[model samples]
Target: MVALTGTMGEIPPGGTSREFGTAYFDGAEWWAVIRGKPIMARWLDPIQPLQGGKIVVDFTTDGKGLSSALVIGGYTDQPRPSTGIAQEVIPAGLATTIVFIGSDGVTYTTDRFIGSYSPGDPIYLTWDAATPTIIGKIQSQATPPPAPPPPPPPAVVTGTETLLVTASDTWGVGGWGRWAKSQNGGEYVYSGFWAGQTLTGSWFYGAPRPALQGKTITAIKFWIPAREPVGSNNAAATIHICAHTSSARPGGDVARVVGPFDVVVDPGFQGGYVNLPLTFGPTLAAGGGISIAGDPYIGFLSRLKDPQVGKLIMDWSA
Candidate 1:
């Protein structure tokens, strides 16, 4: 039996079509077998088999996972099957074609898909050629599951928190960004401490800070005393606020917690406890540190105390 792709079209002028695969017969002699049975041989072309034309086959689908009808090429000269029912079954989860041979030797098929067919079991196929339309049986009868429950409300901020976390001034995510002096007074972290920048900067870089565990950070405050702008050059800084989980040095990518604002110092730079707003910031886990960084020639204050009071602030909830 030849395998057919089940699609067809007409041959163009001065040309032949090969859609028939190997199905053909010259002068009314179709010579092909399907499902181990000889099919009617009809004249498709005037010349040899599969020469001037091709056989056409097409199909249509029905419900979920099922096919309804199939259009088969004609093969004349053989008596039409009187049984009116034919089945071609495949493996499980495969569709079995139920063929109905019409009185004119034309074969049409409607398929009943096996959803979970068992192996070694015979598939039933009973169809009438006169009425090839058969509504497939309901393959599955299992009831659907219930919908899921809704999520709980979000946690609200109840109070405030303030802590002096170590600050650092680093050019990038590279080594501690020039951590020197003391880890306690190393609250100043500068983002401008590259090879060319001078060490006269006023930032601190040291070990990570205490974790604000379960506390939602609101802002980080820093101190910048009044200084001479003549040596400032109207310079600005991009402060990178972070919350790290490491005890060593904090990296930007792994611990950044929001507020990375830009600040420019003009002539009358009011030096006070400047807050890097962390509104709607993330919660700090255990062992988390806070730090900042900026561009070249900019210094950030860190680790504030009662006198200086430059520190990290947050909103705490139960």
Candidate 2:
């Protein structure tokens, strides 16, 4: 990644595999910078919008017409607290657009936080132009969809929908015990799916998201099904639920921090649901799924059966 002000990175020593570019940590590890293509994009939905971060900008020398987007880098407004003048003066480095993978499998880019927009507002996406990263601003440039040929009454809105995770969750085996099926014919870890128990690593996924492919998520709720025998690490514990986007395991750094939730024993004590009430929290990306793991990497277990399959509640709109 080059500086946002257009500084070039140095070439590596002759025999190394590293590319001539920059890298930044995503809170978990250093990421080899990938530049953005200077593509003009159109924002789509989840009915949610974007907030900015490291931009995926086109690094090609032919880059043109991009100076107009670096309105907000978040640090320049330092001492006084507000970027009151950033809207007028562009920063010293080049700022590109933040990246988001579309449900259609195409990558789209926009500035950090995009407010409310309709169907086709254009997202001018670029990446990697500053020390940390630069984000290009999104502008509304597309024609709105043709207004419905109307004589019909407008349809009323409905409440959100929920998705459940009953059996064969994407979560796999715990090191201590092998797989055993309950009466419902679903598989669960017999011993415990706690940390240090697995050589493979442990991070449990609760929601069933294949159906909510294109819809935006408003909330994520989880349930730890009842276990006849409460085991170690089974008592009330706090785990950080995170939103992950790429191939690697969810590390210290994640696209969105969904925040901490306490997994406590319910009043009945059979099993527990996430204890804290989620009146409000972060908005997750469309088509993206969350992972349940602990801070400092503690122990966690998930052994469930029917009537209480690995339950995941998701609230979202069409």
What clash count goes with each model? 13, 27
Residues 1-318, candidate 1: write the lDDT tens digits.
133223212222333223232343456666444333334434334423342223443323332333321224533345433222223334334455554333333445555433333322222333332234433332344222223356678767566655443443333333444444224344443444545543322232233234455555545565543432332536543344444444344343235444454555555554566665554244233444444444444443333422342344555554
Model 2 Cα lDDT, one tens digit per residue, 138-210? 4434332234364777554434545343223223342212333321333342322444432111223443345
List runs of model 1 lying over 4 Å from the truth: 1-157, 166-188, 193-259, 267-270, 275-280, 283-287, 301-309
| TM-score of decoy 2 | 0.31
Q: If scored against the real structure, what TM-score would every candidate get?
A: 0.33, 0.31
All models: lDDT?
Answer: 0.40, 0.35
lDDT, residue 317, model 2: 54
Top candidate when judged by lDDT against the true structure:
1
Candidate 2 C-alpha error for residue 273, in Å: 4.2
